[model samples]
Target: MAKSKPVLNVALVGYAFMGRAHSNAYRQVNRYFTDCPYEIVPKVLVGRSAGPLAEAAGQLGWQESSTDFAATIRRSDIHLVDISTPNDSHFPLTMQALDAGKIVLTEKPLAMTSAEARQMAAKAAALKRPSLIWHNYRRCPAAMTAAALIADGKLGTIQQVRAVYLQDWLTDDACPWLWRMDAGVCGSGAHGDLNAHLIDMTRFLTGLEFSEVVALQETFIKQRRKPDGSGLGTVNVDDAFLFLARLSNGATASYEATRVAAGRKNYNRIEINGTRGSLVWNFERMNELEYFSFDDEPRVQGFRTIMCMNGGAHPYAGSYWPDGHIIGYEHTFVNSLYDFLVCLKNGTDYRPNFSDGVANQEVLDAALLSAQRKAWVTVEQSQHFAGRAEPTRVAAKNAGL
Candidate 1:
C-alpha cells in the first residue's frame, strides 16, 4: 500500500552524441537513485529526421519519436524539455519550453551569445519554471571531492586555477566540416565546447567569479569538406583558444581548449593552488585526486594520490559499485540528473539552472570578445550583459564549493 509517485515525462531534442548521453542519464538515474522522487519517463525523442529519430529512440530507450519540435514542447504530458541541440538552438527551444510552463535541462554554453542567455534566464525566472544545465563534470566524484576539500579550506585562499580540455578530433584535414566548426551554429568551436566546462569548473571549485580576461585564438585549418560532401565550407571558429583571467577573489587563472592537440583525446584537467595546499583532477585519471600540502610534515611533503571511489565517503559513490570500484564518464551525467530530480521533489531551486547558464554564457561571450579585440575584457561587458543576474558568485555553494 505504498503511495504511487507522480510521473514526469521528458521530451528530448537531438539524437546524436549528447542526445545519447542524456537519454542514458534519464534511464539510469531512477535505477541508481532508487529513492528518486519521480517516475521519469523518457517519453519522446525529437529530431530533424523521422527515420533516424525512430532508430535513435529505439536504441536510446525512449518510448516515442517526433519531428515536430514545436508540438512536442507544447504537449501537456511533457513536463520537462531537454534541449541537447546545437548552441544556436538552445535559447529558442528553452524559451518555448519555458513559455509552455515546462521545466528544462540543456547542454552547456547556454546560447549563441550572452544576450540570448539572459533572455532565456529572465523568461524562465519570470515564468517560475525550473531549469538546469548539464555541466556534468561538476558531478564527477573526483571533481566533487576537489570542491569539498577547497570548501573545507584545504586549499586555503585560492590563488590560481589552471585548466585545459584537449582533443584531437579536428586535427586532421580529412575530418569533414560539421555543425561544430561553424560559428553560426556552435558560437565558438573549442572555446565554447571545451572551455565552457573548464570555466564552469573553476567557478564551482573555488566559488569565485571571473573579473576579466585577455585571450587569443587560432583556426588551424581554415576550411574542410562539408558534411554533405558538397565541396568545402569555411571553418569560422577557433580550433584552439587560450586565455588568462583575473578572478573575483584576486586569484589568477589560465585556460586552454583545443581540438588540435595531437595524441590527446579528451584530456580535461584542472589544478588549483592555494596558500596551504594544492589539488589536481584530470578526467583522464578522473577517479583519483593528486594532493600536495605544505602543511604536512616537511619530511613527508609530496603529492599523494587519493582514489575517490569510496562508497562510504564520496558523493554519488554509494549509488553505484563497491569501494575502490571505478566509474566511467557517463556516470557524471547520471549523477547530475539524480540531483536535479531530488531538487524537484523538495521544491528547492537547482544549481546551474537557467541563471547559471547566463553566468557561464557571459564569461564565454566576454572571452570571445576579448579574443576578437586582442585585449582584456571584463566578464560584465555592460551592453552585453545588461538586465542579467549577477555572475558575481555561482548559483550557490553546493557539494561544498
Candidate 2:
C-alpha cells in the first residue's frame, strides 16, 4: 500500500471576494499540482453572519462553518489559519493564529499600518511558523517569467519602470461606501488596496527596494451613503494616488492607482525599460508578454509579444493547460497556493512572508508621508523596521513562461 500523504487542515476567516478566491484555490491546487507532499483540507469557514456563513460553506466546499474567528482559530483540528478578513482584523487574528502555533496566510496590504505589520512579522519570526501574504500576482507565469529574465540580466541596468492600476468600480458617486473607503477600516483606499500590488510586483521583478517617494492623494467622492442606506459617511481615504520613487538600484519609477478611471475595468499594467531591452505586461492581456530588445537590428527593432502559454516550459503553467491555452485571474491564486504548500513540505520559508509585508507597508507609509508633507520621504525612515532581509534567491526557475 502507498504511504498516506500529510494533511494540513485550514480554517478560513471571511467569505467575501478574497475569501472565495482563496477557498477555490485550496480546493483546486492539490488537484492540479500533485507533487506537493501535503493534502490541503478546507476544514472550516468563518464569517460574521450565520446565513452567509452556511451558504459560503456549502458553495466553497468547506466541511464546517463558524461565526467566531477566535474559536475557529483555537480549534485543535485546525493546523493552518487563513485570514481573509478586513484590514482592521488582520493584526489581531494573525497574532492570535501565530500564538496558537498555526501556520498563517493572510490577504495583502498586510495591515493598516507598518507598526501592525512589524508586530505580525516579529511574532512570525519568533514562532517560526509558515506565514504568507497572498500577493498572488507573483505567481502569475508572465510575471514570474519577467522576474526570471530580469534576474538573468536580460533587462540589463534597469533605468525606469511605469506601473498603473486602474478600476472603474467607484467611478459613479452613487457607489455605496464600504470599509475600503473608510480610513479606519481598510487603510488608505486604492492607495493601499490597488497600489500595494504594484509595489510588491515591482520589488519582486526588479529585486530593488524603494529608496524615496513623493506622492499626491485625492478623494474624488467626499461622501457616500452607507451600505445599509442608514446615512451618509465621510470618505476619509484617497480615491486615487500617484507617486514617483527612486529604487535602490538607482532606477526611477512612476506609479498611479485609482478606482475612478472611467473605462479601465481591472486594468493593471507595468512597463519596465532598461539599457538592453524593455518588457511590458498587462493584466488584460495576461497570457502575452511584450518585449523589445536593443540587440535587434536598428531597422527591425520593435516590440514583439510572446504568448506565455508554453506548457512545462513556463513556471506554474504546465499544470493547467497545453501550450497556447490561457489561464485567467483565478489561476494566480492556485499557483500561489502550490508554492505555499511546497514550502511547507520542504520546511523552507515562504516568499513574501511577513517580512515582505512589513517592507511593503513601509513603502506605503512613505507614500502617505510624502503626500502629507509635500516632500520626498525616504522609505527607510526611523519607524521603518531595520531588520529587513537582503535580496534572497528568486524562488521561481528561469523558464520560457
Candidate 3:
C-alpha cells in the first residue's frame, strides 16, 4: 500500500477572474506535481451569492460552496485561505485568516494601501505563519532562467532596466466602469493592476531594491456606465502610469503601465542591460528569452533567442511537455503553487511572501505620492525580506544556461 499524502483543505474567497485562475491552479497542481507533499483539496468555494458560487464550484472542481465567509474561514478543517477578492478586502480577510491560524494566499497588490499591507505583514510575522501573495509571473520558466543568469553574475553589474505593461481593453470609451476604476477599491488602475507585476519581476530578476521614484499618471476616461446600470460612474484611478527610478545598487530603471495604449494587449515586456550582457522577456512570447553576452566572440556577438521549453535544462519546464514544446500562462500559476507547497514541505521561506508584498506596495505608494507631489518620492522599503531560498535561483542552477 502506498503512503497517504497529508491533505490541505482550501477555502477560496471571490469567484471572479483571479478566482478562476487560482481555482484552476489548485485543481491541477497535484496532478502534475505528484511528489507534492499534500493532497490539495479545493474544499470550499466561498462568495457573496449562493447560486453563482455553487455553479462555479462544480465547474471549477471544488467540493462545496458557501456564502458565509466569516464562519467558513474559521472552520477548523480549513487549512488554507485564498483571497481572490478585490484589492480593498485583502487586509481584512488576511488578518481574519491569520487569526484562525490558517495559511493565507492573496492576489497581487496585496492591499488597497501600503498601511494595510504593513499590518497584514506584521500580523503574519507575529503569528509566525507563512503568508503568500500571488506574483505568478516570476514562475515563468524564461523569467526564472533570467533570474538565475543574473544571480550567477552573467548580467555583471546591472545598470538599467526598462519594463512596460500595456493593454487596450479600456481604450474604448464604451467600456463600462468596474471596481478597478475606483481608487477606493483597487488602489490604482494600470499602476496597481499591471506595474505591480513589473515591479515584482524586476526585483526578482536583479534582487535590487528601489531607492526612489518620480511618476506621471493620467485618467483618460473620467467616467463610464456602472455595472448596476444606474448611471455614469466616476473613474478615479489612473488609465496610464509611468515612472523613473533608481535602484539600491545605483541601477536606473523605467516602468510604464497603461490600458489605453492602442494596438497593445497584455504586452508585459521587460529588458535588463548590464555590464557583461543583456536580457529581455516578453509575456507575448513567454517561452523565449533574448540574451546577449559580451563574452561571445566579436563575430558571434548578436543576441540569441533561447527556447525555454527544454525540459531538461529549463526551470519548471521538465514538469510538462517535451523540449521545444511550449506551455501557456496557466502553467505559471501552477508552478508558483507547487513552489509554495514545496516551501511548506521543506520548512523553507517563499518569495512574494507578506513582507515582500509589503515592499511592492511601498513602491506603489511612493509612485502615487510622487505623481501627487510632482517630485521624486523615496521608497520606504525596509520591509523587503529576502527569503533563505528562492525557486528561480534554484531553477537557474539546474538550467545552467
For each candidate, how many residue pairs have backbone atoms clashing (under 3 Å)? 0, 1, 0
Report the C-alpha displacement of residue 344, candidate 3, in angstroms: 0.4
What tens digits encode model 2's per-residue C-alpha lDDT throughout 1-401?
A: 75778888999988889999999998988888878678889999987678988999999999999876767767898998998977767877788788888999989889777888989999998887878999998888888898898898887899999999999889899999887876767778888898999999999989999999999999989999998979998888889999999999899999999999999998999999999999998989888889889988999999999888898667877887788889988899988988988988889988888999999999998898888778989987626432122211111111100
Clashing residue pairs, backbone N/CA/C < 3 A, model 2? 314-401
Give the TM-scores of the predictions, in the order they appear: 0.94, 0.94, 0.94
Per-residue C-alpha lDDT of model 3 across residues 135-244, encoded as one tens digit per residue: 99999999999999999999899999999999999999999999888776677899989999999998899999899999999998899998789999998889999999
Measured with C-alpha atoms, the lDDT of residue 226 in candidate 2 is 94
- Candidate 2, lDDT over the whole model: 0.85
- Report how far residue 302 has shifted in candidate 1, in Å: 1.0
Superposed model 1: Cα runs more than 4 Å off: 1-3, 382-401
Better-scoring candidate (lDDT), 1 or 3: 3
Q: Please give the RMSD of candidate 2 to the true structure.
A: 7.3
Window of ten residues with lowest summed lDDT in model 3: 387-396
Candidate 3 error regions (>4 Å): 381-401
